[model samples]
Target: MSLPVPIDLHVRSYGRVRESDRHAYAQLVLPLDGAVALEIEGRERMLDPLQAAFIAPGATHSQYAEGLNRSFIVDVAPATLDPVVGDRLHERRFAPVGPEARKLVEFMRLLVERGAATPALVAGWAPLLLDTLALDAARPLSRLDALLARVEADPGAPWTAESMARCAGLSPSRLHALFREEHDTTPRAWLLQLRLARVCAWLGAAELPIAELALRAGFSDQSALTRAMRRSLGTTPAEFRRRRRT
Candidate 1:
């Protein structure tokens, strides 16, 4: 079962993790080659190829490595995960990669090794790996498919839950309930996911200035976009763009 979400999966590392800071997006550090020293909250540990770290959104964390190290990094949206699984993961800092989860990690590593981690391939694998980490399946399909399509088509629009509810011809509270029932998320969170997905895809698939891309993705400013991306994907826009280009 693959409980997928709007996530950005990249195979890379942040060398010499010093001062600790935190973001609002949950992240997983699954080692693929070497060891990474990771500290979540106040707990410290060394992560090897078979080990992984689950960093809950807004939890203080940092990392460092003495030599060559790269891990399969997953930047996940917490709202998209099963609430129980997400809470359980947040309570724990480290876990041995289970057989099924390791298989997904290995598959990603192999694809990267073969230079086959194209947008389409990565897109398909991203949600699976995210879901596997939480051991959950996908969210239920939304009944408002038409409204969803319109949102996808113009993600940069000034969209609020109220506006979306009006578009769908429902009261705002009713729309919120429907989103929760059908999508397992709120209207605002869903819209954020749509915008973030667009930004990630565009960062990997095209060339544009960060500021320009920010507005085009419905972010109010460059800093706002950066904060949102860092909070949700566990990576800055520059690093994400660099990874795609190189």
Candidate 2:
């Protein structure tokens, strides 16, 4: 096969609910609009126009996007990239796309839009884009710094909006208002996202039983877990494990 031949390239949108998957080919997600919360190998980060995410072959990953989101994606075969570069890229999660690289990305996006992104053009641009990518940058401080830290540190805790409001030293109404202002979501929704994130992070441990994992994530039972997983991720725990287990 030609080195420049990518497995796939296209623009895609993600939903508000969290979903998980893993694939044999590496992928790069460059946002065309809006931001996405992406998790790979248990690490979570936000991906926006200024930032992009890289997923290594076979890595278990999950995503949730706020509002509307569309991104340019390139799925690359493992053998298509240089061994050294691919190895380095496997560890890359979210990284800053420099000004020049952004320009190149825009140019290529226009080409793809115009139906001009041929195989050779993609092959050439793909590696060059990867080469230009740097390591993940320092994260920006979150608006809900203290509250988010506590919740993230203990996502499985029996957390309620009232409890969270107490922890944050805000009234329930004020807390809800603040979440809506900053995150465009309510307290319950954010906590659910946190619990779901915990589920994804722990799902990779093959020895840990799914039922136990569900309880740990604060779900009532395996049935509840399955329902939540299906509602948020469109897949059951068993299917996620079967497809994503390394």
Candidate 3:
């Protein structure tokens, strides 16, 4: 199952209730102040202070907060952690809010409140946090950070498995195998997704001309950009720009 990529973080305080429910593309519930019970995969687990539960995109889960006062929900995409966390969405149920996790939580809140002021400039700290979590779990994918940095450096650049392999200091075949194990997709497809994500951010922030945006996103033309956008984002560039303006 694919996880929802987290673009931002949310913090909410709720009173005692029988059920606290939400459905998001991806979510991580971190209890900062109290204990609670969560039902995931038809099992219940208690979440103490600084404990966290991860929910895959659209995972059907409910929360029962026993005298809980506050919680932090950090949104992330499957692509963001899949390479490091592996495929199992509902992995281990309890992650201690270690110093690293706490720092990540604080950093995520700052980014969410400030928002990404510039297009194509994602808040880097979130991915770092995920990397740290993966490291703590001892399933580290060493090439992940370097690979993402290359993609972010130039999403418009023509990229291929060979190119990415060169970036990661691995052979093309080796890179492909690693990507399949870590990301469950080919390198080319992942690159396309990253480029499209940047395009989405650009469309949301500025009303750039379609042709220019397509070129900037490394597509052959506007039609290529439109088709890919529709496939990945469920809307045309025109519609996306319209919504952003509203």
TM-score of each: 0.48, 0.52, 0.47
Q: How many backbone clashes are present in model 2? A: 0
Superposed on all Cα atoms, model 3 deviates from the true structure by an RMSD in Å of: 14.9
Q: What is the model-wide C-alpha lDDT for candidate 2?
A: 0.75
**Residue 31 Cα positional deviation in candidate 3, in Å, after optimal superposition:** 28
* Winner by TM-score: 2
**Model 2 residue pairs with clashes:** none
lDDT of 3 at 171: 94
CA lDDT, every prediction? 0.73, 0.75, 0.64
lDDT of 3 at 117: 29
Compose the digit string of candidate 3's lDDT tens values, residues 185-241: 888898787677667667766556988988898898999999998888799989987
- Write one digit per residue (lDDT tens) for candidate 2, span 123-157: 78888787776432333433354576556545678
lDDT of predicted model 1: 0.73
Least accurate 10 contiguous residues by lDDT in model 2: 134-143
Model number with the top lDDT: 2
**Could you give candidate 1's per-residue lDDT for residues 116-140 as a string of tens digits?**
6776776677666655655522222
